[model samples]
Target: MEDTTQYFDKYEENLQREILKMCSSLGMLDGELLASEDIDFKWKEWAPEYIAVALPEVNNYPDFAIACAGYAGMAAAHWWDEDWGRHHSAEFDSLLGPRGFDDMDEHIVQKILGLTLDSVEAKQIMNILLCCAQKASTFIRHEQIEHQTVKAFHIFARTVKVMFRTGAALELKRLGYKFQKVDLNRQLPS
Candidate 1:
């Protein structure tokens, strides 16, 4: 099997474009308002590639946009390991809805995480998560605030926490790191 780095190299361009498109779709890209420099770069540099990948010709299907967005977020996490990717991952989790939460136990979390960092599973899952994250981040950054922004932000935060926890566990497992299983109620440090 190919290593994570090797796998990512193949999809990095597509991942970047997918992230950009998701961000744009979420309305996060704004030229006028001055926010964090990193955020600006994320929109300008990363988002376009996302757009390219998510374009109808590239993705073909309607749902492909969402899938591309998720993939973008996952790829960003793998590449940057910075705030942009992290936030994008969080957003992706929010979009994924509640379907996967029940299985967020240590074993499942470990398995997913191991799969993610180790490139064990098809990269599609990672791609989905990344795309979701990019969309969420874009929403948070660009959308005008009403009651919905608060709700969305909350969801985004929760999702990010879950993904990070699971992703971290997987990374640890891949590295042959061991840990004790603790209660799920307690929050893991960010």
Candidate 2:
């Protein structure tokens, strides 16, 4: 019988081959193709800070890759905030409304959530959640002031959590990883 370690090694080899095959089929495994995309947005967003703390030995990863990693880290941080922070605070309610917050733009929501309305899947979900949040926050502030409802708070929290998770996924996809579901609870701050 084969040893357990040998089985594990064979499994790993098979996984690597499958991943390489998929990458090749998608035309993403080629170094030239990787180099061709304008990952300048990611690089500009992440390079300086990474360079500041990078270890000398592993400095060869492309700027875009480092930027993508940094974005993933930031998304993790934001998820923590959504999970633990008092997302339904009076201040937050006051900032969302039919008239909208004086300083808030719908676009600001996209920027905060790191989403764009251009993609069909992302656009549909984001539009629904953002509109719901805006309306719910407004209702809480203007209509529900007499009594705070668990239902309202639940809606608020769910919306915020979705926004954070969606943002994280977008950033990860931008970095070229096939996004799996983010485990939000695992990211909650201790």
Candidate 3:
């Protein structure tokens, strides 16, 4: 039988490969690419601060993979907020298209939870969740009185909580610890 760590390690590696490929395809793989387009406009100035805060929390992991996942989420939220939906892409319209930021908060949470991701799949799902967390946090910090941003902040907080719990569960399972799927809705008691 394959060791659990091997499974997690392989899963992490595969996720990284996919992230790299997706970023490359979007022309967002590095600093140079960041300068090549309008994508940077949507990235919050507070993103780096959020990333700095997140990095220490995942310090024990090799390559700080958790932080990377969080960063991916932050980036994806910026893109989705600025680039996706009917306003940005005509072909991408859906009934759930950005229906104000408050509705969008619920949408983001639903999107994250609905992923039903395996460890290998978590690479992408976790990234999007973390990104949403960071973006929402930025809005909350900067625009404290905005109702939509506040609601979004709460939703994104749940997202961060869920993402961390999910990652921990995967790691624990990899370490040969038995884990049951904790209802993510109840993952944050209170």
Best by lDDT: 1
Best by TM-score: 1
Best-to-worst ranking by lDDT:
1, 3, 2
Model 2 misplaced regions, further than 4 Å: 1-74, 77-147, 179-190
lDDT of 1 at 40: 31
- TM-score on alpha carbons, each prediction: 0.27, 0.24, 0.26
lDDT of 1 by residue, 1-190 (tens): 3564454343433334444354335443221111233333333344444444333322244233433333333333333333444454333233222443222222222332334444534443444345554444454345343433444433333333323322332322323444446898988899
Q: Which residue pairs show backbone clashes in model 2?
A: none
**What is candidate 2's lDDT per residue for 1-190, written digit by digit as tens?**
3574464445434433433343345443331112211232333343344333322212242222222232322234333334424321212222222543322223333443455557664454344334333432443354342333544433333323323333343333435555246877686676
**Candidate 3 or 2, higher lDDT:** 3
Give RMSD to native, each candidate. Answer: 18.0, 21.0, 20.0
lDDT of 3 by residue, 3-69 (tens): 7446434543444444434444533333111121222222233234333444444324312223333
Model 3 score (lDDT):
0.36
Whole-model Cα lDDT per candidate? Answer: 0.37, 0.35, 0.36
**Better candidate by TM-score, 1 or 2:** 1
What ranking of all candidate models by TM-score puts the best one first?
1, 3, 2
